[model samples]
Target chain A: MARKAGSDGSKTAEAIRAAGLRLIFEHGYEGMSLRDLAQIVGIQPGSLYNHITTKQALLFDFLVEHMTRLTEALDAALAGIESPLARLDTFIEFHLRYHLTRRMEVFVNNSELRSLEPQNRAVVTGLRRDYERRLEQILAEGTRSGALNVPDVTIATFAIIAQLTGVVGWYDPKGRLGEDEIIAIHRQLVVGGLLPIP
Target chain B: MARKAGSDGSKTAEAIRAAGLRLIFEHGYEGMSLRDLAQIVGIQPGSLYNHITTKQALLFDFLVEHMTRLTEALDAALAGIESPLARLDTFIEFHLRYHLTRRMEVFVNNSELRSLEPQNRAVVTGLRRDYERRLEQILAEGTRSGALNVPDVTIATFAIIAQLTGVVGWYDPKGRLGEDEIIAIHRQLVVGGLLPIP
Candidate 1:
């Protein structure tokens, strides 16, 4: 019975996180209420506390978890890539593919930073910086190796990430272009941008 | 006395719009209340109706006003630029400069589309497409002249706009790079990306 209860508790916690993401996505963090969240999750308002401490904590958790998984997945994708250019290509494709399917999470993550408390904001910002540093390092490596001609690694890092991530804003699964086609086109833009004028 | 009343009414309406922008920027559309808006504007709740009909109307007004101004400004900036390359460069620079100074407006415009009613969203989306078509035409012109090698005009349009508009997110007037310098770096990334490989 104790084991069953433990499993049920974990399940409820997972449900809370999922529902919180949807609520925060539909309504901004400030717009969503605990009562609304509880109702959506089919739990009593009081039982919500059993799963999550507070709304702020739930948001902080969502952001931290998203950033953490993003960086980890990126690392996995880039594991075997040796050349700087190849690594850069992998990074672009990885970012696009990862973000394409997680539109709601990305939307909430981008829009809700204002609602996070200062300390929580700092933690999430640090995680973001860590993720950005991964790309910056790749760009820096390419610049040093003479394989690429990035005017400034820092600027290129931001520009490339922004360009790639923009796909999430407009990508449609039912659209004419397939995911692979979209990735290929963006890879051309980014990789083509970085390559030395031949 | 009637003339004075008209002037005061216009001033109050302007004040209401300004306060509404800030409120929507700080709190999402659903999160902001008419009472809060009236409080910030130092008017009674009843007086808000004198300036704006409904919260929805106020948000619609803000979006329409923003999109209108953005496209008009783009048109003005691109005027007299004959060459497709120059026009594209001007578009990038103008988008960055225009968005950088209006961070709050841009943030609300991008993030609050979700809060818009479907009809209002369609209207805003149409305006956005009109703005995007400006770049698409430029890309197509360059492609036709063989001066630029855009893999796909539509994809390039989205990618370049996203790359440029992203500056608003992280731009710091006090940062090491001046606005011109930042613009130049992105110009290199964008224009260089489109130039045929030598």
Candidate 2:
């Protein structure tokens, strides 16, 4: 919502971003418009423009924020866990949990990506590559340590991720199994593909 | 691209769908339009409307076409394959390969799905559910025979699929691996998770 300019501007901007994300994730990038965002946030149309540069900026932020936050958390979780296999486990579970809670965010990340301008698309894509690179490193470490056996760590990393990204399209929080059970099953699935023989 | 009635009229319809698919897959459901498809296919804009009732119908076909084909192929592939694990492997590899080779179709099946109207959406989704039901049956059969070890077959089906679907978003024909090799690796990855204790 629009608010007093000076110190309160940032709050308005944040609110607009959140409201826009909810709409875009539900209606898709095509269905949602700036006016819709403004109405949702209870702000004047002109005032909404002040908070964000353009609709693309709101979408770009919506798309990348989840990955940005998750990768940072993944970095922290992977920090001291020296076991490569364990590291992979942590990453998959973290990914499942992230997608489970912010499933809409995951949908936006997968679908609304191309709506971004060329430069913005590259930045968001760069973040994805960064995450893949980290996973590739962990996988390479696993191969070296005799904990995993797979061909081409980089390829495997991407393959594993594609498997996980589908969660957003289908995961139901109110389903028969709770989130932890889903995570546990995914861990086994991922590990089955990568883990090495004793 | 418009042609005579009867047989030629069907061909005209195919041309329109092909053009729509090319634009939509490259762009998105929102990115392409009837005029664009007509222009790309070298047809008059008015003539385009003759083949299809509306833009949304084309969008629905875009989502349904490949999936309908794949389901047929899957049934063929899985038929009479006694080993549950073997059937699962075939499903995984076939999915990865199909998406890799026919990327436009893949994009249509995977992401442009939301553009369908409610009944059309249900039809396509039901087709997808049918495919998954087969996989779950196989998984259940494997578990029943002590051929695969898993606490839950249903969730595992989704997990396996997520990994397979991710392949399309990243796979490049010119990249280090060919489709067959990628499928082999996918087999290794999938088998690791689904196979019973070795």
| Top-lDDT structure, candidate number | 1
TM-score of 1: 0.97
Considering chain A alone, what is the TM-score of candidate 2? 0.89
Pairs that collide, model 2: A147-A196, A148-A196, A162-B166, A163-B162, A163-B163
Model 1 lDDT at residue A32 = 93
**Model 2, B15-122: lDDT tens per residue?**
887788887766667656678788887889998878888888888776676677888888887788888878888888777776677766766677756677889989
User: Each candidate's iRMS in angstroms?
Assistant: 0.9, 2.2
Tens digits of lDDT, candidate 2, A1-198: 675657577777778878888887656676678897898888888888677888887887766776688789889878888888888888898777766777667777877776789999999999989888888998998888888897778778887887776676777778787888877887888887776654
True contacts kept of 2: 0.65
Question: What are the models' TM-scores?
Answer: 0.97, 0.91
lDDT of 1 by residue, A129-159 (tens): 9999999999999899999999889988988
Residue-by-residue lDDT tens digits, candidate 1, B32-124: 898998998899999999889999899998999999999999999999999999999999889999988898898899899998899999999
Give the Cα lDDT of each candidate. Answer: 0.91, 0.79
Best by TM-score: 1
